[model samples]
Target: MPLTAAVLLRSAALSDQEFLDALYLSTRDDLQALAADPALRPMIAPMIAMQQKAQGLSYQASYPGAEYLVIEHAGAPVGRAVVHADADGLRLVDLSVLPQARGQGCAGSTLVQLQQRAAEGGCELHLTVRLANTGARRLYERLGFDVVSDDGLDARMRWRP
Candidate 1:
């Protein structure tokens, strides 16, 4: 049977560390693809390392001031999105869907959830995407995010509430 759209967007709890770690590691290929650029390689390497380390800790201990939402479908965690408040707005710090779940609207649905949370807090939404990640950029664009600044390797996108 095909997966349904009843995706549960729940705040990731401490026990979800293993699941988050698995999700993070599963994105290695995607990350390596982005790291192919020499300019982005240096910046992304350290950040990736930091993320890996953080994934080792309990979610509650590591993600303070951030809302980490796990997207569950068919009773399994398939994606994750993190949002935090910034002076500009509610910034999306990270968002990823498993390779197998990419085209199933998981990412878009997760974004809708994040946007709803931001709306409840009366804040706009913002995020940055690598210039080479056309798929992600397109998704953000489709969700009403506009390029606010071009930082060569990445573009800072914003959605005003």
Candidate 2:
């Protein structure tokens, strides 16, 4: 049940936009649920496209120096991660695994790799998880990340080497 597949990270390219958009859609539970209704299904594609574009622009503006990487298993991308590292610490700006790959250890392996990098750099690792995403929060906690702050909707977590 743990790390069943080996994962690798590589710099994402513009060519990966289509795959990234599909991955983004797959990771959005709310959208998927809404699309389950026949009336709403047709609207999902356009919404996903617009949202993905906005998210891309937002990330570029918010973390100008971040590394945008793709998560791959057996040579095919299954997820994506955005990380920003500086004198302060490493922040995992975003991480998302495709629905099909969710339980196949993709996310856990990726976090393990990031944790190793933080340890090697001697700086803390930081990430913010939506409070409603209890599963992901538990995963972070299991990996030694503790909540440093929490508002109503999200929790900012930190892990020290």
Candidate 3:
């Protein structure tokens, strides 16, 4: 079945907590799969937990200048993307989708939404991805993000609007 065009992009509300938690939990298996490197393996769970906490806290109160968008498909929350201004451009703080929502264009659609939001704010978009996450890298590249630098395990990518 085709996903509904009714997929909506909107500011996340407090009611989305459970959906957010589900999204965080869904990434565990994927994260583990990417943790093939001995050094990276030990860091996966901690990093995922930390990111989940950070994302959850981001909904507490609106920061001075940050925009967090939640993507919903067929009335159910499926993903989230957050952008904040930085010296170089609009930094992508988070971009995550539920496991079931992967490979369904949800992440790509969220990126398009983020790019539009960034453009409206007069900024380019930037994000850091693990070098080993080729699937994510490919998605980002498809959305016009170019690799700017690699700091060990992380690659910094930028998308100029």
Which scores better on TM-score, 2 or 3? 2
Residue pairs clashing in model 1 are: none
Q: Candidate 3: which stretches are off by over 4 Å?
A: 1-3, 30-51, 54-65
lDDT of 1: 0.81
TM-score of each: 0.76, 0.90, 0.74
Candidate 3 lDDT over 20-103, as tens digits, reads: 766776767777666777878778767787887875576445344676678888787888877677677778777888887888
Question: Largest TM-score belongs to which candidate?
Answer: 2
Instruction: Give a tens-digit lDDT track for model 1, residues 68-149.
Output: 7898977889988877776767888788888888888888877887788778888899888999999999989999999999
Candidate 2 lDDT, 75-144, residue by residue in tens: 7899999999977699999999887788788888899999999999999999999999999999999999
Q: Which runs of model 1 end up more than 4 angstroms from their true locations?
A: 1-3, 30-51, 54-64
Candidate 1 lDDT for residue 42? 72
Give me candidate 2's TM-score against the actual structure.
0.90
- The Cα local distance difference test for each model comes to 0.81, 0.91, 0.79
Q: Which candidate achieves the best lDDT against the true structure? A: 2
